[model samples]
Target: MAGDASNRDLPPVDVAVIGSGIAGLFLALRCFRAGLSVAIITKKSLSTSSTNWAQGGIAGVLDVDNQAALEAHVQDTIASGGGLCDEQVVRSVVYEAASRIKDLVDQGVQFDLSAEGIYDLTREGGHSEHRILHSRDRTGAEIERALTEGAADEYESGLRIFEDWMVLDLVRRDLQRPEKGVAGLWCLAPDGKVYTLASRCVVLASGGAGMLHLATTNPPVSTGDGVAMAHRVGADISDMEFIQFHPTALAIDSQHPFLITEAMRGHGAILLTRSEYKEWKHTDGFPSDFSYMNRYSTKGSLDTRDVVARATDTELKKSGDSHVLLVTEHLDVQEIREEFPTIANKLAEYGIDLG
Candidate 1:
């Protein structure tokens, strides 16, 4: 691991990670445990990545009767992927999902649990079973805290985190063709000093370009720097068309869209058109009416994210509205308040409580 090497000797690290999100940090931790020196470079603090903003939980099967669940998970993923998913890759990740979750727990992540002393799994779009493991509403934040704490102990020892450092480009042996392999990176420090760190391997897990869209749930740092750099270095990039957008982002006029986690729907919230909601409230003063998703799929509100997002867009176009409403009136108020305190409180700012 090497950082703050402006005056000191720079050492070559075994691995160089160019992001501090869950993927990058988790990979760094694994490499460190295997006795590999690691360097993590991020333009901002470790907690500033999109990982800290994730609200929905990780999807996986933790119960013993996981064979069918795993199969369903894989199938659901493939279906949602619109037949473009690589079956081998899908199966590999699906099978390893539980073990990865266990690794997270081993690293100090505490997922939500039921009163029966079992992991309280919840459902989301594209999930057949309640296999999502979350820590209340702040699942991402909790995991980020745990991973940051774990990485801190290894920092400057087995791992070095370079915060406020921007990666300019990958240092490749042959700029003409990146097939030669990446040696390291050219980085710009906060003090306007440029430096380079050599490494045996470099990983670009720098996340997505959600900020490219006008309304996105992504943080400002998700400006597709990794993709751009990789493309510049002649790396093969794929699936630029498959950007996943959540269906229920909190749309306040002209404000950055805050994600309304799909887990809320998994917990029983139903999506409704503005007029449908208004009419329903006028009729009964409550949101017990059926949802538009019921007309599209048997899963209703539990349909896949792609389906829901498209449906919302269609409804918006049809009705000429800005956004849709997610009705949680059918769910228990106390349970919602307890399970999604962050969302509940945030909605309260806009004069919306679960009750």
Candidate 2:
């Protein structure tokens, strides 16, 4: 249900937040807690953002025994960024990761724990330590669920959510004056009416522009609407060409490609050449069959995403194969099933089982 704002003529609020993703929802929550009225506008349902579809865990330096982990995390991030990274920004965000994680936990976001009750940290590409905080394989969904539910108590009273409301542009008091700041938004409501919602501050949290590609793992709503509107309002955009592509998106003969998370490799799943996979298809599956990753890099299957993705592309093109196989038959079946119930169920539909 959307476009159902009963009080169209309501007074201006303290903040108008566009998009209902993790960024927008968390912003709204903080503003409301500070005694500010918030209006959250989303183009579609509140739960359809890219954050809800993310499979990987949030990376942070969390282990106490790993005292050198913080600097290591920073260095790894910088290396992954390939000299384009802002060192100060990287240091700030990495150092503050623990507190932000604590904030999420305080808001009832439960991450996966080992049998000993410690965090079940897993290593993905470009990391030296296992510092990822995740809830099984569906970390993003878990985060979205937690934030959405946590904000429910303050919804009607403190935060006003406008779903199916397409934000067309940011409203400025003086369009000609460049120094004048954003005042609010001009949104096209679901009721086929363009309404002007006023606020002291307007926040654009609309997600990335992955939909610009014909084939992408990004949600359909990721049409780069936020960037577009920001450009129109003369916002200074940076690093517009540095979009990262996931290396192992599922390439089945489907219109929408599903992401084959890099975490699968973190859990000992192997990427195999089609010929190697066919050779093992008739025999009992073994780990040796999926050992092709070592041929590409010294880190083997644990290489950084860009490396792994480029290797996969190279192998596919070299062999003229449409798709490659991710082999997990050697991993413990029960562990894989329980740790990745969502992914297991999804593969089950395609007659593939990690178990």
Candidate 3:
């Protein structure tokens, strides 16, 4: 219920999983269901991972209803991933996206549905269609909560969960095991005690490596620990460059960075400039002159994240402005409030009223 000390003398389990993020939780559930004893070790509280802070919905083909849309989405992802993306891996993950969502739904993960009872999908900047399945704006939170609950049920049986257990290094016996075979690990407990956990199989689900940058939406614990550890053990790393940056972050002076959900833009918001504001104020009396996004892509505000962010940065530089504005005049004020209550509240805290 609280914490567990590692007893090196105790018998090793079938599998030892590091990190309790989405990847870890799902791995534990699958292993448990397969009758494999699992021990999950996390460096902090269970809910403190990057999965909890994820606001954008997962990309999947839930509503495509045809192969063309699915192929297009896959192609778009491949293009965005650059030439480095493995076509086989892309096809594998894309093909499984729908089944994965279905599995989540079967596991009691509640995805948002429209009034017509179809899975409510949203369009993100890089995406071609409205294929992202979500549960309101807190989609990741919802999924994590469900997975955690499911994991708890497994724990009720015999699954082991260790919180505040930071892994210092992995223990691999054979350095020449074809694919970097793992044997065990050396971890540091919250009390500064060292642990040697031996296992038949070891999994490193320790999330992304976003902390290397000055400004990252990733949590404090995401320091590329897993990647670093794996690399230390001679494991090959891939895609070290594909870091996605959201176009809108709350541009406030704070010790910690806060991300403004891109879903707000998907809901019909427009990025405006100060000069464009002045021009619109004198002419149309509404900010419509800041249409630089239209020059890049037909998706405009709904362009993929990389496109929109680049466009926004260009506009800010060209206009000699520190901050660009996102206007949601097309969206009903009350609807925006209801859909993005957290964002509206945060903006209000900064003396900017959404209404």
Candidate 4:
């Protein structure tokens, strides 16, 4: 099922894209639009990717009316990136966030919006303001749906999509004349066959290496394959220690760490020590029982992800507990249901009533 088309007299493709996640699909679509012959190779079905499991909305600068909000978000991101982020890249990504979001909308991606015609942006940890555009807690799924549809259209237009093909190794040939550079890859197909794929350009957008950690929010397939492959190919890797940890993954029976969006905290959910809540309830008067996150940061619960996660870890360690309570007393249960219907329903499976 996998072989160098050159061996079989098939037409050569202009580009070969590995992986069918958001990055790969979007790039393939762009290349197809540019009139280049393209092919996407995936190890499993195209739908199996880390992007599909994301519950948090993509962060973007959508509202010009909230310039401060935008600036704060940029600052928070930079801080969390821990000096590893290229300033230019960060700025470019931040500034272009709105435009990229618009591009997705133009491509038929529907994000949730408010009654006021504004994009319903939510705040996550490390964000200064509510700027995450979501679709009822399934933002990734919605975006993936749109991207996959667009990719299918490209496939119909003659772009090749080889599904269920596992890539083994890149087949690079040394130049005899010393002028021609490296060759291409030897990919493995599902049927236990190997094929050589020679291309002038090969793009690897395979995603992160969350599999090294015993406890990670990444999908099973997120085994740092791209990073490992790049390392084997002699690409200089940096900041291997820096990893982003979301604080509110559901602790009950989650096969993978099911992330609870920080938007819940942004909307006034409080992370509490069970002892604090219990002690306050048992006392004569409820003495301001709430432990607001300002004790951790000026931004309170809206502090950057690192801050929130560190605080959570420290609090849990001090309390000798595995999990802390997320109190949503200030938020209306009906509004929570309306805004996060999927999460509301998912929590019901564990007998945790969001109502």
Candidate closest to the true structure, highest TM-score:
1
- Please list the Cα RMSD from the true structure of every candidate, rounded to 1 decimal place: 2.1, 2.4, 2.3, 3.3
Write candidate 2's Cα lDDT for 92-179 as tens digits: 8888889888878887888999999999998798887788889988999888998888677777565788888899998777899646
Misplaced by over 4 Å in model 2 are: 1-10, 63-67, 278-292
Give me candidate 4's TM-score against the actual structure. Answer: 0.89
Lowest lDDT sum, 10 consecutive residues, model 4, at 1-10
Q: Per-residue lDDT of 81-186 in model 1, one digit per residue for the tens?
A: 8798999999998888888999999999999889998998888887877888999988999999999999898884658898888898988888776799889998
**C-alpha TM-score for every candidate:** 0.94, 0.93, 0.91, 0.89
Top-lDDT structure, candidate number:
1
Would you list the C-alpha lDDT of every candidate in the order shown?
Answer: 0.85, 0.83, 0.79, 0.74
Model 3 TM-score, 2 decimals: 0.91
lDDT of 3 by residue, 1-355 (tens): 4345547433577898998888998888899899998888889987778898887678888644778877987898887765667899888888889888887888788887888998878877667778888777778888889888888887788888888888788887887672757888888877677878888888999998778888777889888899998988888888787777778887766535677778777777777776665555566554434566778777777776888888888888887888777777646999778767767877888888774
Kindly state the number of residue pairs that clash in model 4.
Answer: 5
TM-score of 1: 0.94
